[model samples]
Target: MHITMHDIYKSFGTNRVLTGVNFDLQEGEIHALMGENGAGKSTLMNILIGLHQRDQGTIMIDDKETYFESPKEAEQRGIAFIHQELNVWSDMTVLDNLFIGKERTSNFGLLNMKEMKALATEQFRKLSVSIPLNQEAGKCSVGEKQMIEIAKALMTDAKVIVMDEPTAALTEREIRKLFEVIASLKKDGVSIVYISHRMEEIFEICDRITVMRDGKTVDTKAIPETNFDDVVKKMVGREITDRYPERTSNLGEIVLEVKNTSKKGQFKDVSFSLRAGEILGFSGLMGSGRTEIMRTVFGIDSLDKGEIWVHGKKVSIRNPEDAVKAGIGFVTEDRKDEGLVLDFSIRDNMVLTNLHSFAPKGLIKDKKEQEFVDVLIKRLQIKTQSSATLVRSLSGGNQQKVVIAKWIGIGLSVLILDEPTRGVDVGAKREIYQLMNELTERGVAIIMVSSELPEVLGMSDRILVVHEGHISGELSKQEATQENIMTLATGGQ
Candidate 1:
């Protein structure tokens, strides 16, 4: 075995995050560590990388016991971690970000800029990424940034690399490219610990699968010996009879319409219509303008020139308040930065958007507020100790549920979700799917923007692919395939 973790336990205060978790990684093999959000996948990975100390555990690397006091120690021992969130600097160039911490000094004590750039260039070549070395990393697309992150880890001469949702932000084409890179890495005998909610990718790439649930390891099986359904059943502890809720042909008249929506440098000629009881999916490459289209529609960013119609009447949306007033709900891609108020409790955040409805005689109704929050908590299956628990104290999936519940409480005719299940676990993702079906059943229109091809394919009745600020293609549920979507997304004519 390349790495072995036994009897791992970690806790935050009185709450246990990881419980007696055990896992092993073998050389020249791809091992998938599967779990839902708050299931201790991140905690266990952090322990391996030394971000958090385990309460009890024994870590063995290459058949020898090892203790990592810091991430640098883990790095020196040929271990590298690629986080879900990119850790590169936005202000620095790609070459600089890769070589910033450890610079090779010449005999005269000068930084070796030429050698560093050459090495960074070589690494990018190996990954089939063509990012400019001198360009600021922030200007690159999310997929480019991801490739850069992985390249940095590889540059460390890592024997084992733990990737957390590496393809969450990538498009179908980029995902295929990533799989190729992973295959090459496996051929070179690099052990990979892959964590993802995507079971299809797990079956496609991983050699062995380890299932984690409620902070404990349930089973580890070879990929060929197990299937996606079996792995999901193990991760969720129940069989999912339906991947998506039943859709009825009960769509009402057009609720929201965009006429030739153009955001100049962001998106162009984006025309789409949403009606009650329909889920429309927007999909494309990282910079394909899916999120940008949502932002423009939500009035977070001004449209260069376009006409918006709500309920068959032309309306000018100058700000988010206008969009909200028009009965449009938007859950942004960056939830932490744009969606949640981390310091507030669930009740406070729940009523933030619709406080006027619950306030009586200009007085906030605490009891009524609690009632509303409680209803949402239960409706969305949001796991929490209490409705009064601070939003930040919850896991990523629970936090997302809170965000969705907040909007569902306010009442919306058109809902826009950008990467709604990006970091969410399988169980929570299924719950969200069920909630979407329930909402559609009640005649609510949904516009979902996602980077996961399988998710978009599985959940959407219609899919729109964007490429370089324009709509490249639109595919129906029957026509949508990984091959066709990737063809259009990567500039195929």
Candidate 2:
């Protein structure tokens, strides 16, 4: 199958998202869509998949003009999409989520659990995934959920698959497995539309690349013809000399400390100390209890046994509110599920954490709130028409920024960041790193949980490697390297 979109234009109210964009996909090849968040890559795809109508565009498939009325129509035409955000049904079992709308049924029209489980098991095996078919989808880790999404898409018998940030949550081992699966699919004459901000992976897997900027298509080139610098220049329209901003923060006394923390079936005997003006980097594979440990610290999940101390005083945090009162803020890994209310406006989401500070005596000072929101929006470079804009409409990168802004307004003593730059582009990523540097300069301690080795090595003053719920090893910034971190993360000596 071959697909082409030309002269695409889209707008929401007064916000112009995409204008005069051109993209094309060829059979038996991998085409990459590279851009910063809100650059209209997603909008163009959404228009193609019939989720949204294009105000102006021409879509052609196999030399004939074609437009899908719904995603079901596109799926029936052999096109599948694995979105950046995982779409797993939390309450449903893994098998159910795998065949959600199109379940297998017997001759009598009764449900066929055995057939569904067998198909799901085969897909998981192909992806080298080990998740149980009977487990609740929500119980799976982010990486596991990511793999499930990929497997579900593969089960569609799609000739063309559009994958957006598919490996953002995957571990090195799983990433390798996914790459192998992609290779096999390509060999089977499937065309792939790969979207990711990871430059390395794009160059490694894609055959051609298309970059968008400010609602326009900058250029398209073969992967062999374009270098990483060229693609980034087109994506952000600027030369990024440093991938990561230099870190300079003097360490102070420990601000938050956890001792002998244990969460049943998650982590065990975990202990760590976070000091003011220092970035404590948590390095580990996904599902290695890194996120669970932070959830326990933030009181989202209970610690079966542990002691938490803030500012050298013990605090009993029974819930997230209690954790907030104790001066700890958490930027959760799953932003859509835990960080922001999709239905709420950007302003409303920003003030969720600092409501007490803004609303004295149950009265909100609208002027002060607006000013605060405006300042952070400018500081963070969040692309939004107005604070009244709903958060659900913002791009993934901007949504993550809102989550960070909400926690930043709380004036917490300790901040826990999980996968802070998972879907962020190069320019915005530098901006975030600069913000972290400034925050540390202001004496706020941060515990960053990241799967990106370069981020851990670049921004952290100290690093702790986690393997299967244990603190396998700790290393200073000067001593840590990718090899050492991987060795420790994989439970090697």
Give one digit per residue, the lDDT tens place, for model 1 in 1-493. 3889999999888778888999999999999999877788878988998988999989998899988999988888888999886687889998888876777778899998888988988888877778899999877766678888988998998888999989877766668878898898899899999999887888889999999999999999999999878888988889887666566547788998999999888988888888888889887787778888888889999999989998999988999999999999998776665789989998788788989988758998878888888888888777677888899877777888888887885778899999888878877888898888888888889999988777788888788888888889888888999788878888785
Top-lDDT candidate index: 2
Q: What RMSD value applies to candidate 2?
A: 1.0
Candidate 2 TM-score, true structure as reference: 0.98
lDDT of 2 by residue, 19-81 (tens): 999999999999999899999888888888898899998999999999999988999999999
Clash counts for all predictions: 0, 0
Q: Once superposed on the true structure, which residue ranges of model 2 sit more than 4 Å away at CA?
A: none
Q: Provide the lDDT at 353 for model 1.
A: 90
Query: What's the lDDT for all of these models?
Result: 0.85, 0.92
